[model samples]
Target: MSTTTPPTHPQRAGLHRILIVGGGAGGLELATRLANTVGRRGLSEVTLVDRYPTHFWKPLLHEAASGHRDPASHHIEYAALARRHGFHFVQGELEALDRSECLATVGPILDLNGNDVLPRRLLRYDSLVLAVGSVTNFFNVPGAERYALPLENVKHAEEFRQKLLTACIRANHLREAGAALPEPTVNINVIGAGATGVELSAALRNAINLLSTYRLNSLEPERDVRVRLIEGGPRILPALDQRVSAQTHARLAGLHVDVLTATPVSEVRADSIVTVTGTELASDITVWAAGVAGPPLLKALDGVELNRQGQVLVDKTLQTLSDPRIFAFGDCAACPSSIVGVFLPPRAQVAHQQAVYLSQSFLRRLTGKRVDRFTFRDAGTVVSLGRAGALYQGDFGLGLRSLIVGGRAASGLYAFVYRRHLFALAGLTRMAIETVSQWLRARIRPSIKLH
Candidate 1:
């Protein structure tokens, strides 16, 4: 009897091309795992495509904005990592997908000098995964989109920092010369009651204070600098226990950081964010940290069932119901688990756990073994409210306040989160060396970026 090895892709002459789209948390880790098997072993050619040329853990963007992190020094360049990990890195916004034909078009790459780096190219893949992640949900508040910056990535945070500094310096100069002070200038208004909004508001306030001390002697940062966090919800960090939110509220209040819950902004402007109560919170900087929605591109894909928000709906095995040949997970995917009742919410925990599940599932497929259903382990929430410190949760759904830590201890643990991520990717030996090196570098130089 003769047996045949099935071709990976019908169009492929022989080679199997496995393309994983999006370099976000789940996508990147999945690519790495598969690369160790397929790419390193030469059974498959793995390619990771993303709009950005590098990858930064999405959770730390606020700290990057606060001058606590240097993106240039910390981010992992996708090109470098791909080369080291036995995968190909391709940078392009996904233009179109032809699932039936197993074809994808990655187009129109240009160089800094306006030369064509790579022309419109077609890729063939036997299997595909979508992990494009998500963006903030502005909820269509009047003028919000036109005015506020959203904390989408490190670039967005860096842009906000630069603009905020310029506003501060210009205002200070005008005040020193006895000119009329700029009204509604340099005040930052952040919308949303979630963790990102709360933490970013606090981080920005701290950064503004530090900026004033180092570069703006002419400006009274304490008096002139203002941060208003407006949330439609009754309290900040509503996802966490009431005690966590209350303690965070107190810490922020002690810093004179304005926290207004249940007060929704009716309008936003280039220079101010106006509340429904008719209070014009003068702001030169506004941030939309509200909520998240899936990318709109997923709706165009053939045979992929998507929710109203464009989230690819998947089964407990993390396989898309419409076509099991493709799988979508992470923030961009609505992976439903039996335990969660509804779709699993997009959190770092969700993404991390999903990656592990997907990797194992793929391994099981190759070995002809059974795949386990994904179970979301709800480990409490942690909210970092800048120098005011942090909050840790206890019990998954009981919402217990029995276990809590904040201040210096909480801050240290907050730093540990990113360290743990790096450890997972690079192993303990590499992460330990990196931790020591970063500490030494900080001691040798000024802690904050002067520019």
Candidate 2:
């Protein structure tokens, strides 16, 4: 590892050195917010570290995987964002942490061909934030890690898209040549019927329909493509209201996506999946959206307490139990919920709220004022169903009781949530311009990414 320090603005005395690791939703927003506030005011030296150079919203990965959304259009470059927001951006992975010295070790920068561009180096910090987010949890299921594709990052989504396209083309060619095939259709098995899996299934069906209509003319989408959403729970979207689940399940059925609930997958093979009931189903492609656990990198944090799910144990203030200077949030930190004996769910809303709270908390910290405990306010949940529309559940101003909404109103609300994220990051002007640009692009470009 090289001993040279990564390029950053020289730190000035009396400025609080705040280091935030992980450029996901929470980390990036916090960096942008604090950079615009305290960093701009010369009160703190804000630095954001991340493994990747660009930031893409995780909630949109499923849409990218289904080829319904183009990731390049939405990804934000850290360097450019930092320049505009007045924060130092460090491009490297956080490998280890030393609380006593208040330092973080970032791994070396590596090129695509496996050569090191820069050696591992240490970053000094007065305060540290870990928002590295979660990773796919296979739960020790046999052959799952090897056979299933995960949607943890942009690369994974693109890989799934390319493979889906290739499979469709190959199947169409076979049909056109009158060749005998082992299976009648190209089967796509999506494990777990959470928001990700359900949305992906719906998007996949829409993509297949568009592909058949435009590109793969020889193959009929209904006859040649099969999308299956398998879940272990009694119903899809088990976390949401049962009414929402029932409506979503019915809509998926109308879209011809087979929804299998209460059927846990015991094993995932290269060409098939074996259920706990000893049933084997053919699968050309499999996506694992089963569950997520805290990233394993948290283990390297010296003496930090971790729960069984590998999440960092933090108090209401979002500070680690072992170290007050070290903080964590988003999906990586297990913060207590309002309900007794339960922790907050790993949702984007939780992360966004924590980020907003942290920005204010930091401002208060600079003034030597009391830092407020973070509280989560549920804005509700919306699941996209592509062109078929969307389903929304949660308090929609109906006195805290959940309201179920469907069709265009629900779809518009679903879109507004994403726009809100953009608004938070880029402000009103840029967000509005971007929204209009994307709308215009949709008119000119194909509904699905062709290449």
Candidate 3:
């Protein structure tokens, strides 16, 4: 219960302290931008606080889970990023917030053995930005939290990958020993047909095929490995255009993925899943990608208005309704699309756009210029279908006309999104080096991680 005081920088005296909580996509980018601009010239002091020591793009979690990409190679250390960008990094979970005193209290850090590493600390700030991302919401389904794995972060993705490998190896060993089991197959159930679930199912198909091709497992991937994608809705990718959804559905079907639409999972068990229609499905591993709600810390923050899903309610400028100095964005903030009169969808694109807008707004505020409201532009949606391909749907013009594209061209566009994010974080020179290094590494390393 010891209280730790934050270190002070003598050179940064009298400078406005801008504290950003959560080092997710939007928060990290905003911190980098502010550090490069305001903190570089000593206009303000920027500090980023996050629970995790490293960051991996959320969209790539599906690839990590399927062993197509190793998260370690893709993740960036927060401390190194802070040093390179001229900002400060604080590693701790947010415990409490005192809005009147403009102070944020971070909980103590502990080692794996449960030994205290760092005592609780208090961070003082002139302006606070909350970009703490969302967590999986099981909607109180029985046994879901106990049995199912949620692919919300790098750790979860790694856990799933290990579990998947273990299941395959064990099944292979049993078959080699001439053991006959009632159910001689490895079944994986992915709940929810959104982008995460669909993409994960597709990637799993590729990984299963590779495992069989390399003779890593004795079981036939095409016949023994069963992947079921269950969606409560009438069709997959409900938020996207109908044409794009149909294309993705067809692609998944061609990959031998069993898509069960209009079927809601009533409960999850250790070895099976029960649907609302009184049907039982075999599931050696269950993954929950159904829905998301803001982290619990947001609801605990006093005075901040929260939506039904626990997201912070903010105005067009992304400022919280309760406090002018407190702003929130990304998946944790419910920012309204003034043009369309609806809340912005929780996506990487929305978070990236918000980060850019917030950076500009802060710069304008420093120069006594007028800060404009955030207007969200619809840039379309792209869903990756692993080796099968990708589906792209967007309005090419400013109007509502729909344009759909699929196959290799759509996959290229899908990859461009991640490349754009990397370019934003690392400048052109560093990004080019990264691209070339990745290309070289691919030539030497195995396509999928075996262990």
Candidate 4:
């Protein structure tokens, strides 16, 4: 194994080094935009470091989990993206930080067989940005970590998809063998009424319908497959308006999803979920999408001040409270909101806007100009309901009420949000090309991944 200390890249010696950790929606966009401006003019050397070699949008992980979207087709390699956008890509996890020395220690990269692929290295940076994102917050529920699957990344999504497929196939074989079967041969319980849980439950129902029609003709989707959504709150989407929540619940009913509000999970077993009310629900697959908190790495960030949720605390300028040279944003940072004592919500739009704002702030810094405070404009929320439809509530600025939209038009708006993210990373020409390619591929390939 090899060890290296600082000076990781061979760039211009006098240029300022900007190191960004994490390649989520916000980090990648900031890297691309900054590379086009400051990095292009040789004012600073930009480098993006991520544990994964590829990036997949976190918002769409639910679709991947339900097999509605293929992970491989949508994944963007960091190396290729770096070459196109004029930035450097480093694949490593940030393990330690030294605020006094302005240095970060990255852990070693290992292969599947536990062999070393890359040695531990140190990266020196003039400015560091942390966007490492969040992880599932189990809240200390008994057996949740061991039994419930969390849709935090691509691997978890794919694992859930495969297990779902296996459960369906196994049930079909049991029926063929003339064995006595229980009601709802396959039971899937998703604990959470948030956007991820709601969207995933709908997607799973749709996938099951398609599978019964196309492949598992012997199995009846409605009679044999059950999808249950459990929420501790009084209603689903507790964060949104009451009208929006009511509309979404009705739409879910149309898709035959069982929504259990005010039902808190007490324990998760390998084959069952126990609620706080002492009700035991038999579950073939259990998904935890209830909540998220900052990753454990944030706790180790060299005296960085974090909130109760383990998210780094940042001021209006998005810089960490402990050090000005270090910054945080997206799901990892608890950025102050316009409302007193409230942090911004963890949404893709919020991150996208923050990325744009940070890029401009960096450019202004070089000119010795003042950096303005970051403000987030409410852009509304959109929820996907598979092929049935979607619900969208638009936030009208000022004192005007929000606009509620439903059906196909709402679905189109949902698609546009993802395309807009792509446009930020790649220019319009490439984004358009990617759009056309996905359209073509959908026509040729199976709707769901068989494997």
In model 3, the runs with Cα more than 4 Å from the true position are 6-11, 182-184, 339-341, 396-400
Local accuracy of candidate 2 as per-residue lDDT tens digits, 109-203? 98887677977878899999999999999999999999999999999999999999999999999999998765557999999999999999999
Give the TM-score of each candidate. 0.91, 0.97, 0.97, 0.98
Model 1 CA deviation exceeding 4 Å by range:
1-16, 38-43, 112-115, 179-185, 337-341, 397-402
Local error of candidate 1 at 46, Å?
Answer: 2.3
In the range 1-451, model 4's lDDT, one tens digit per residue, is 6465555888686788899999999999999999999898878889999999999999999999988899899998999999998999999999999889988998889988877788888888999999899999999999998999999999999999999999998887887787789878999999999999999999999999878777887788888899999999999999887898999898888899999999999999999999999999999999999998999999988789999999999999999998999999999999999889999988999899999999999998976799999989888999999887899998777677778899889999999999999999988999999999999999998888776
- Better by lDDT, candidate 4 or 1: 4
Model 1 worst lDDT window (10 residues) = 1-10
Off by over 4 Å in 2: 1-8, 396-400
Q: What is the C-alpha RMSD of each candidate to the true structure, in Å?
A: 5.1, 1.5, 1.5, 1.1
The candidate with the higher TM-score, 1 or 3, is 3
Q: Where does candidate 3 have its weakest 10-residue lDDT segment?
A: 3-12
- Sorting all predicted structures by TM-score, with the top scorer first, yields 4, 2, 3, 1
lDDT of each residue in 1-451, candidate 1, tens digit only: 1122222223324446778889987788888878777556556677888888888999888878777778887778888878777788778766777888887766556788866666666667777888989987778888877778888898898988787777788887887888765443457777886888888877877777777778777777667777778888899887777888898888877766789998888998888788888888777788888888888767667678888777888888877887777888899888775555577777887888888877777766655688888888866567787767888875545544457777787777778877977776666898899889888988986666667
